[model samples]
Target: MSEWVDVHFQALETCGKRARSAANMLTVEDVFQDSSAKKPADAAQASMFGDLSHSGALAGKVNDVWSALKEELGTGRSRLQGVEKAIDQVETNLRKATKAATV
Candidate 1:
């Protein structure tokens, strides 16, 4: 029926919107801190200290961003799969209805 088709389409559109929002959030980096080097070290010890500090901070930020992006991607994938399954169910139902009408 047209009603059933409309329902399925609406559900699919909602899922798609959610997935896109999640993807956009995952791509954004404003929440993540910048890990740029502050200044050049004058001495060897200072250089080593700066290197260690910068590397550690950068690594932590990178890890956090990676984890957040991964979670978002997983959520998007799950939503997409749900939408696919819903569409498949609708198609199956439509086919069955058509077959019944024919018979």
Candidate 2:
């Protein structure tokens, strides 16, 4: 392989590794919808603040974001696979060209 092609292919391999790592870093969680906010226990606070019931709301929102990010990460992983396959095809074509020239 020519030095230029070799370098470019190596760079692709490195990029693929980085992409995979990034995908793995995003974790999926059980996302849920926020239920109706319940009335607060503190009657005075409840009156002052109204319904603020959601103990689960914050968790649900976080999980929802995590799940979305995980899906996006899966798409990125698929793109990385495509890049790897394209690199392989390019290398194969280069080798074939070199063989034909020598023959």
Candidate that would win on TM-score: 2
For model 1, the stretches where C-alpha displacement exceeds 4 angstroms are 1-55
Please, what are the lDDT tens digits per residue for candidate 1 over residues 2-74?
6776687677567656655554544324334354643223312333446575765665665677667667766
lDDT of 2 at 34: 41
lDDT of 2 by residue, 23-82 (tens): 454333221224355322432322343465863565566556655666886777677667
Clashes of each: 0, 0
Off by over 4 Å in 2: 1-52, 55-57
**RMSD to true structure for each model, in Å:** 8.0, 10.2
TM-score of candidate 2 to 2 decimals: 0.50
Cα displacement (Å) at residue 102, model 2: 1.3
RMSD of 2: 10.2
Assess candidate 1 and give its lDDT: 0.58
